[model samples]
Target: MTTPHPTHLRIHQLAGLKPGPKLLVTGAVHGNETAGVAGIERVLKQFDAGELTLLCGTLTMIPIVNPLAHRLQRREGERNLNRNLRPAPIPQDFEDRIANQLCPWLAHADVLLDLHSFNNPGPAFAMMGPRDNDSDLEPFRHEKAEAALAACVGTGRIVEGWLSTYALGLQRRAARQGDGSRQASLVQDPHYGVGTTEYMRSQGGYCITLECGQHVDPQGPEVAYKAILRTLTLLGMIAPGAVELADPNRPIEVLQLYEVIDREHADDQFAREWASFDEVSEGQLIGTRHDGKPVHAPSGGRIVFPNNKAQPGQEWFYLARPSDRKLKP
Candidate 1:
C-alpha cells in the first residue's frame, strides 16, 4: 500500500467570553476556489483586534483545507482527495486521515460553517442540510437560515443536494447498524454519516455551507467580508447592531440541480474551454470522448466543472442548474 501525504491540521482558538458555543469555520476545501481564505483571515484579524466578539461560543477556523491544492493552484491533488473520505475501510491517503480527525471534531460543535467558493463568476449563496430537523414551525430558524444566507454573499440561490447527500449518508449508516444502540446512536453522534455536514448534524450541530464567489475575482474578498458578518448575526453570535446589512436580502430561487458523470480513458482527450456555470444550449458540444472524440450535452442549461483532467470511470460529472431566463422555445 502507498503512503498518504501528511496534512497538518491547524486549530485557532478564539478565546470567547469564557465558555461558549463552538463554531467551526473552514475554507478552501478546494484549492482552486479560495475566497474563503481571505474571509477567514479577515475574521481572525477582527477577533484578535477586538472588532467582533464571540458572544456565546468558540469560533474555530481552518482557512485552507486543501493545502497542497492551494500550493498547486489546482482543484484536486493528483489523487482526487475529496473522494477519499469515509467508508474506505482504510483511509489510504493524507486527505482521509484529515477527514477522520476533522469529522469527529466537527461533531462536537454547536454550529459549523463550511466555507467554499465556485469556479464561476456568479453571485454567492448558501447550502443547507437536507433534513429540516429543527422544528419547522419556528420562523426564525428557517428564515434566519435563509436570511443569513441571502444576506451573506448576496446570492439568494440555495442548493438542496449537499445536505440531502449528507442525510442519506447518515441514514445509510444508521440502517447498517446491527445493534439498536449503535444504530440509533450513531445518527445522533454528528459524525455518523458520510459528509462533513452529516458529522455536524449527528453531533446536534447546525451546519451550513457558504459558497463565496468567483474563484479568481478580486471582488470575492469584499463579498466574503459581507458573508462573515451575516453568518455571525444569523447564528446569534453577535448583536443585531453588530450586523448592519447594506440592504434587504434579495429573493432567490431554490434549485434542484443534477449532475452528469464522465467515463473516459486518459489517453483519449477532450477540450475543456467551458467554465463552471457557463450557460449551455441543448445539444451543444461539451467535450471529447475518451478515444479522442467529441461529446455533446443531450440536455443542458449550465455546464459545471467542465474539465479535461478528469480520470476514467471517475466523476467527470457536470452540474446543471435550470436557467433563470425564460425559455425561448
Candidate 2:
C-alpha cells in the first residue's frame, strides 16, 4: 500500500465495519488479458461511488498485477508471470519483482480471484486449484474445498488438473524421437508448474482463476464483474440478498483437463478453425503433424483452449472430460 502511484503492483482496499475474511482480487497476470483489469477498476469505482457496500470483510483489488507486460500488450514481459511463484533469493525479472511484492498479499488473503482470459474464443470458465491426485499431495485433500470455492464463481463450468495436464504434455514431449536435448531445455523453462491460483491453494487459502472468455470480447469484462460479485456474496463479504447468486439447482458442468496437445513440429496445424469447448467425436481429425500425419481425437470429448497460433513444442489445445462431482458449498 505504501507504493507510489503508477506502481506496477497497484492496490486498492476497502475495510468493512466488522472484521471478516480478507479477499484479494488480482487481474492481468498476463498483460494481454485486460477484461479482468477493467472489471476490477469498475469494482473499485463502485466502492468509491457508494454503489456497492462492503459489509464484513476487507476487499483488496490489484487491477493490474503485471503492469509492464500489460503496457507492452503482450502475454508477459520478460517471462510468463503465472508460473513458478515460489520465492526468489533475488528478483530476476519484471514478473519476479511483481511476484515478490504480490505473494505476501496472496498468502494473507482468505480468498483470491485471479482473473484471466483465453487466446481462443470461448465461454467463461473457472479454473480451480489442483486436487489430491492432480498434485503430489495426499488423496482428496483439497478437492472438496477447491471445488466448493470454484462452484461459487458461477462460471457453471469448472476445470481442475491444469498442473497434471501440463506435466503429461512435458512427458509426451520428452518421449519424441531425437528430441531429448530439446526436452531437457524445455523442462527447465520456469513456466512449468503451479500458477497463481494453485500457489494460493498451497498456502492454505482458497483461490480460483476466472477465464472470462476471449481477450477482446466485450462480454469478458461483464463476466468478470459478475464473478466478483458472486464470489463476494458466497464468501459473506457482501450481503447475500444484495447480489443474486447462481441458481443452486442450475446444471453445472464439471471437467478435468486430461490432455494437452502440443504443436511439436513446425508444420503442425489444426484441421480446422476450432474454438474452445468444441466437442469432437472419437477418431475425429483434430489436426495434422509436420510429417503429414493426421492427428485424431483420442476420445470423444470437448476441446478447450485450442490455439491455432501455438508455437512448436507448446500446448496447442487441451481435451477435457465430464465429471459427476457435486460441490458441498
Candidate 3:
C-alpha cells in the first residue's frame, strides 16, 4: 500500500501470518459521527497491547476518513463527503482529494464495514445493498454474503434500496422540471447516490453501512466497538470466542425504502418532530408543504432518515415498507 497524504487519512494495516480475505473498516466518514472512531481506536489499542491478534488475512482500518471535517467537528469541511464518493480525475474539493485516496482502499477490499451514526433518534440498523441484480451502475452479486454480514453486526434491523431509491428521487426531480437543465450541485449529480458502501459493492465486495445509534447516544461507541469485534470474528480474522455474537435465531426485521421525499421549500416543516422508524398511518399528517398543503403518508409504513436540517432540493426523509427478504444462515 502507498503512503497516504499526511492530512488526508490515517490507515492502519494488520496482516496475519496466513493469507485470507482482505477486510476494510472505515469510520468518521461524517465528522460528527465519532462512535466508529472511538470503537476503532479501542480495537487498535488492544492490538498494540498484544491483547488481540489477527489470525489470518489483513485488517485495514481508517478511523478518521475525513480529517478536515473531523477537525472542525462539522458534517463536512466543504460538502458532504459521502455523496458522489469516487476518485476525481482532477480533484477540485476537499472531499474529492479524500476520495482519490479512499477509493483505492475500497477497491482493494474483499469486504467493507462502514460505521456511522444518525442524527434522529432510532434503533441501530444496517444499510444493505440490493439483491443480486444486473444493474450496470451498481451490480450486486453477493447479497447472501452481505446479508449474513449484516446479521452478525448485532443490528436487528436491516434496510435496503438506498441507491435505487435515490436514483428514483433524482429521476422524479428531473421529470418535475421537464427541462433538460442539469445543476452542478452534489444532489443533482447522476452519481450522487454512489456512497461508500455502494462503491464497495460496485467493486465486487460485500459491504454494510452500520448505523450504531444516535450521534449523542452514550452507548453508540460501545455498539460500534462490539460490531467491529463481531465482524472480525465473523470474517475469521479473529477467533470465534474473541467477541460474543448475537443470537443466531434472533429475528431480523428488513425494510425496503421505496420513496425519498425531497425538500421542495427551504421552510418546509414537519407537522411535529419526527424520528427515524416512526410509524405512520396512510392518512397521517407528516408535514406541511411550502404552500400550507398537508403532506401525508402515502401508505402504512415507517419513516427513515428524517433530516430536519435539509435544504431545498435535498432529501428530507424516506418512506420504507416491510420487506419479505430473509437473511442467509
Arrange candidates, best lDDT first: 3, 2, 1
* Clash totals for all candidate models: 11, 0, 0
Worst 10 residues of 2 by lDDT: 132-141
Off by over 4 Å in 3: 1-6, 176-184
User: What lDDT score is found at residue 99 in candidate 3?
Assistant: 94
| Residue-level lDDT tens digits of model 3 in 128-165 | 99988887767878989899899999988999989989
- Tens-place lDDT per residue, model 1, 1-329, is 53354468667767567666677877777778788888888888887898887787677788877676776787755444444234335765556666676776677677777777765457666665543446421112333443344345455666645433334344444444334542245343334324555456555666677777667778776666667776677666766765466455356655544555444466645455666666777877766675666777767666555555665433454655653321111
Models 1 onward score TM values of 0.71, 0.88, 0.95
For model 2, how big is the CA root-mean-square deviation?
4.1
> Highest TM-score among the candidates is held by which one?
3
Candidate 3 worst ten-residue window by lDDT:
175-184
Ten-residue segment with the worst summed lDDT in candidate 1? 135-144
Output the TM-score of candidate 1.
0.71
As a whole number from 0 to 100, the lDDT of residue 245 in candidate 2 is 75
Candidate of highest lDDT? 3
lDDT of 1 at 258: 55
lDDT of 2 at 108: 87
In model 2, residue pairs whose N, Cα or C atoms come closer than 3 Å (at least 3 residues apart or on different chains), thus clashing, are none
Ranked by TM-score from best down, the candidates are 3, 2, 1
